[model samples]
Target chain A: MNKRTVLWTAIVLALLALLVLGCVFFGLFEKSVVAKDVDQPLSPEQMKTLAVRGAYVAVAADCYACHTAKGGAPWAGGLPFTTPFGTIYATNISPDKEHGIGNWTRAEFHRAVRDGVGKGDTHLYPAMPYASYRLMTAEDVDAVYAYLMSRPPMKVANKPNDLNFPFNIRRVLTFWNLVNLPADMPPLDAARLEIWNRGRYVVDALGHCGECHTPRNIMQGMKASEYLKGAVLEGVVAPDITKDGLARMGFDPVLLPAFMKSGISAQGAMTNQMFEVVHFSTQYMTGEDLAALSAYLFDLDKLPDKPASPTQPKPVAVAPELATAARGNYLALCSGCHGIEGQGIPHVVVPLSTNASLRLASARNLIHTVLNGIPGQHFPGLERMQPMPGFKDQLDDRQVADLANWLRAEWGGETPSAKAEDVAAIRRDE
Target chain B: MTIALKKLSLTVNGKAVDPVDVPDTMMMQDFLYEYLNLTGARMGCGQGICHACTVIVENDDGTLAEMRTCITGAHWFEGRKVRTIEGHAKRDASGAITQLSPVQQAFIEHFSFQCGYCTPGFVTGATVLLDELKRQPVARADLERAISEALDKHICRCTGYVRYYEAVRDVILNTPGLIKA
Candidate 1:
């Protein structure tokens, strides 16, 4: 062969050899890391402890929210979560030897739970919230794994995710994780109190409150600038929790913990999605934790000034027939709980006449509450009370309107009365 | 007409009990509430999205775990052992009755429940989480995640998710090294 040909051939072979060596080196390195991380045998006590921590982790991570199809076994998967792109069904993570992650190794489980990588190098969708989970510490991940491993074996198989075209490729998740997920712990602000820091850590990491409350970009990433100012999820609006007085309920930060725990805001009662969250999560939290959260929330400085009050529209006078019926119903049903004079059992039951929530400037709230019973709130230093029964079934539309009108005029002091049409509108909305 | 009944043996709240004849299609939730009088595990949603019906199913090796009883058939629990929230509040060494487990205490201190409908489920789930963690050294993130996971099966319509997270976090943060384990 010619010298030139031989040189070219030699260079080509050298390049090929280098590529092979690089691949092998990477493969070995990956295996070493996996071995270092995987299957670290845990003691039974340790395992049990992990299981407990795992339960808490699971709660914060909201695993069952996306997994566990409606009416299906918890963690058995098959819940169809709809996104802007398409519907995605979460996989079964239960300990079932088949149809679930039961056969997965500790490393495999960790990868799926924290890294969003599934078995056989499959990439799970971001809907799994692994991007946020990626910030979880190794010990936290291990505890979750232990807890999951200890679960009773469920045999339910996971349904395949329905994604369109290129999005369906699982390998793409590695790229997504690389771009969107954080591998290390979140940076702590030294200036903040330990409790506040702790609250921030939980909110940002395992709690992932921002995932729902913060607005998102076109790529579905959270808009860092708009963090926790509130956003919409599943057609439900998560009200801005920022101390934006104009944008939020007009209460000070001191009232936030109580509001969060009780679903009673200074401006109004918790409605829609916020109510659900209060019922599910916040009411159970400690006063100290709530206080810490409130402290952090109060410290937010970007709020706008409160808006000027608008002029009240003309009130619709209550019909005589409706007024008589309302008074009679109040005497029969409500007087037992709330005294005939509108003085509720002190501390035990909220007094209607003086209660700020009941006396809000709109009869809309009173109507809502009377029609749909208010769920109890858990304020610190207060005993938990049974929820008030809704009078929707017993009261006619006109009766509800009359009762709300009377209550607003008599107890609310300044609020306008509700009309029959207003009650009809609320009934229709429900 | 001939009547058919199935006989099974299972451990309930740490005690072994001989199974009586029950319909094959009887729901585990019904069996617990009607037959065993284990009302601690509730039936918030009969379909099982809510973990109100959760119970700790003990394996043969003495290790216990949580399961939802609403959708599970009684036949599936034939040879298993189960513990409910009621079982967690047992007598201590001195034989005096104690009402609060660590999980329960954490819940109460935190004021975790609003309507109290989902509290039992959360308590049961939290107990399992605490048991698994061993030492209570949970970081803030870990604590939040732990509470979230424990509450995944239950739905509360009162307090926003904040209080539940706080209750569990309080227990972990207060208890040294529990979250780390």
Candidate 2:
């Protein structure tokens, strides 16, 4: 062979070897850093205490429902959650030294659980529910950590999250944390009773009930101003638990605890997602806790009444066909629950005549409820009152749109029209 | 396949039974139904999400605690004692098991069940909660929480949650020194 050919081949081999060595070195260095930052060993006694605490925390956190792979080990996480953006998988949290957080230090664990930061400073997607966990006390976090470490180790590697380009950029979460996240505990109201304060802490902090119950801004960050004023999540409408007489099922503060504990209100029983929350979390809370949650929730200032007249009531002359059909449908189906005069069953059904929530808000709830009937309880004493039934199977998307538009126009006075497209979107939710 | 089983002796409902060998993976609910014929704990969601299969596990201390039988394996009860709802009603001086526990009475009085499916779990759970709170009195608000938390595992679809709350509240209020009526 020629000397030139041999020299060129030798150079190529050396370059390839150098590249392979560099890749291996980089991988080892990354893992070592992560291990050094995250892993911390626990004593056996601490493990036992943590196990007990973990059980309670697991219940409190409702972690199993989200983390456990369908029919998998309790905390050996692999649950897939789908969102509008993409699907996210819950990582293995079991005490598996190799696959899970078995190697994570207490501080690293705390950061991941509370602050949503991972080892090597990887940003966890907000889907981790750290926004609510941020409210957890240090001790609570420790107890949960203890429980996780105490569990029998399961070797389950976590699946990668499937978020789109911009969202997959984990570094952007650093900014998301700064602007949207409230990393600190809520300031305690000194004037409130200890029990009431505890309730506030649990609800606002540990329970993070508002994360689901409260409305959100355009960026999906919770709207603090409209906290617990009800929001639509996944597909379920978390009703306004606030004591806006018209918005809530006319539930007074006194009755709110009963509602929380039992998932029933004066007007109707809770169904769907709210039912599960109550069954798992609120129902397990101490009565004082329930009362405190109710007390704090009831005290929020009622939403300011909208002016009777809109400054610019955009006149979308309702299409001739839609107007007639919507009016006819409302009279036939709604008047039974909501009286012909639009004054609903007092305290039993929300009055439509002057209902601010029905009039001014987004038509997502109206469309969804009309399409999918509300599942409710029939507790012993109140067997007669069943929850609202879904009309999805019965009504076309356009019909639901027309009915919702009619309710808003007639009751709320002047609001943006609910297009057929809105109904279609809500129907596709599940 | 000849399965190897472990012999375990434990008191159930205050009655001592002969030790029996059973598979480790068998659920507590199946064990209770097959061996003891104590079928009060109904299986609703086999998954731990619903508490229909709750039974009171008598701790080493005198206190009783609730655990779901469906999800928990029978092997966990190797040396543990348990009290089902069937065991809750006691025999009075008359030598007949005529007296229902306060929780049971309260449930009956308040009409807590509609389909009567989740009642046993609620009853068993409430009994344990009441027993724990007996030593230290709970406030009215605390009573509600105690009851709700106790019965939190159980799911009832019929007769909205109000009646169940009322049933537990009645038991707490009626029990003197626990909570003021």
Each model's C-alpha lDDT?
A: 0.66, 0.69
Q: Return the DockQ of model 2.
A: 0.01
- Per-prediction DockQ: 0.01, 0.01
TM-score of chain B of each: 0.85, 0.90
Estimate, for each residue in B35-147, the C-alpha lDDT of model 1 and write its tens digit: 88778788875544567888888766655577767656576577788887777777777746577787787777878788888888888777777766763445656666666
Q: Write candidate 2's Cα lDDT for A1-430 as tens digits.
A: 8999999999999999877656543332222111233246567787677778667766667766667887787778888878766889998888888888878878788788777787667778887878778877777777888887877888888888899888887766655565567747757777766656766676776677788888888777788899888887877667666657323344555566676676644334555666667666666666666666666666632212231222222334555777667765664355545555566663345455554435435677667667876544443234323355466754688888888887666555545478888888888974
Q: Residue A72 of model 2: what lDDT?
A: 83
Q: With candidate 1 superimposed using the best TM-score fit, by how many Å does residue A177's alpha carbon deviate from the native?
A: 3.1
Task: Give the Cα-based TM-score of candidate 1 against the true structure.
Answer: 0.46
**Residue-wise C-alpha lDDT for candidate 1, range A1-430, written one tens digit per residue:** 9999999999999999887656543332222112354667677888888898787666555565566776788778887877766778878888888888877877887777666667777667888876677666678778888888888777887777778776776654544444455545657777776767666655666666777878887778777788787675653345466656222334555566677678653344455545555655566656666666666666642222342343222334555776566655675456545655666654335556544444444556567667777666554345443356577865777788777777665555444466778777776753
Flag regions of model 2 displaced more than 4 Å.
Answer: A1-43, A50-54, A217-219, A235-237, A243-248, A300-363, A374-390, A401-430, B1-181
True contacts kept of each: 0.00, 0.00
Question: For this target, which candidate reaches the highest TM-score against the unseen true structure?
Answer: 2
**Chain B global fold similarity (TM-score) for predicted model 1 against the true chain B:** 0.85
